[model samples]
Target: MKKLITYIVIIAIFITGGTALTGCYVSSKVANKSGAQLWGENCNRCHNAPGPGEFNNDNWDIIGTHMQIRANLTKTEVDKITEFLKSANN
Candidate 1:
């Protein structure tokens, strides 16, 4: 009976801990950030990013997709960065 109670407590702790950790992977809010800001915050954290003029809109889209995954960026961040690059490319 004592062992059974200990096992139940351990299981409960594991369940709660897992749920809490899961929140860290997901974006809590879509931040209102400029392209340059997002680029600096997310992209520059890992490596230097090329100037916006270096790539066309389509290229930015492709590169954004790849970087999104590589950087673990949220959809909102990807969209903002892509828009920023597109505007700056002009």
Candidate 2:
């Protein structure tokens, strides 16, 4: 009976730890996605997104700052989208 209780406790700990680790891994993956992917997923949610060529790099920076606040984007998402837009502008 004591061995069974110990086994149950070990399994419970493994399950909880595994779940926490998995959550972290998934969040990191989302945060690290390509800039284009982040832009598509997040920016498009509110309205039509302009093409990268539609604005210069400076304009993009300004627009990104505004949209970042309006859309409540994470810092990582804002950085990725800004990088993607600048790259696409060229």
Candidate 3:
């Protein structure tokens, strides 16, 4: 009975530890993704995602600032998306 209980506790610890590590791995992968990927994933949720050519750099900066607030995006994410849009518009 004592050994059986010990095995169950060990198994439970492994399960929880594995779950935490899996989350960290997934988060790191997302952090490394490019702005285009992030834009495609997030922007289309509300409105149709526009072509990068639809706006110039200045327009993109204005739109990015507005969207960043409404979408609750981090400043870093907004900057990456803005830069990608500006580059692709050319």
Candidate 4:
């Protein structure tokens, strides 16, 4: 009984640690992405991807705000995508 309990605790600890490390790795990967990469990955997930110059900065700002909610995107992602669009439009 004691050995079984010890093994279970060890397994639980490893699982928890693994999950934490994975989350950190994923977050770091996201942080390193460029605006263009994020735009391609996120916008295309729902409908067809829009051309970067399809809208002005103001327009992109509004769209980004909408998408942030509708698409469940992080604020950082939306900001990056919006910036990419604004720059491309220019």
Best by lDDT: 4
- Candidate 1 TM-score, true structure as reference: 0.64
Off by over 4 Å in 2: 1-26
TM-score order of candidates, best first? 4, 3, 2, 1
Q: Which ten-residue region of model 2 has the weakest summed lDDT?
A: 23-32
What digit string (tens of lDDT, one per residue) describes model 1 on residues 1-90? Answer: 999999999999998998788656655443446778888788879888777778899999999999889888867789998888899767
Candidate 4 lDDT for residue 29: 76
Stretches of model 4 off by over 4 angstroms after superposition: 1-26
Give the clash count for each candidate.
0, 0, 0, 0
lDDT by residue (tens digit), candidate 3, 45-87: 8888887888989999999999999998767778888888888
In terms of TM-score, the best-performing candidate is 4
Error of 1 at 71 (Å): 1.0
Lowest lDDT 10-mer window, candidate 4?
Answer: 21-30
What is the model-wide C-alpha lDDT for candidate 4?
Answer: 0.90
Question: lDDT for model 1, on a 0 to 1 scale?
Answer: 0.83
Residue clash pairs of candidate 1 = none
| Stronger candidate by lDDT (1 vs 3) | 3
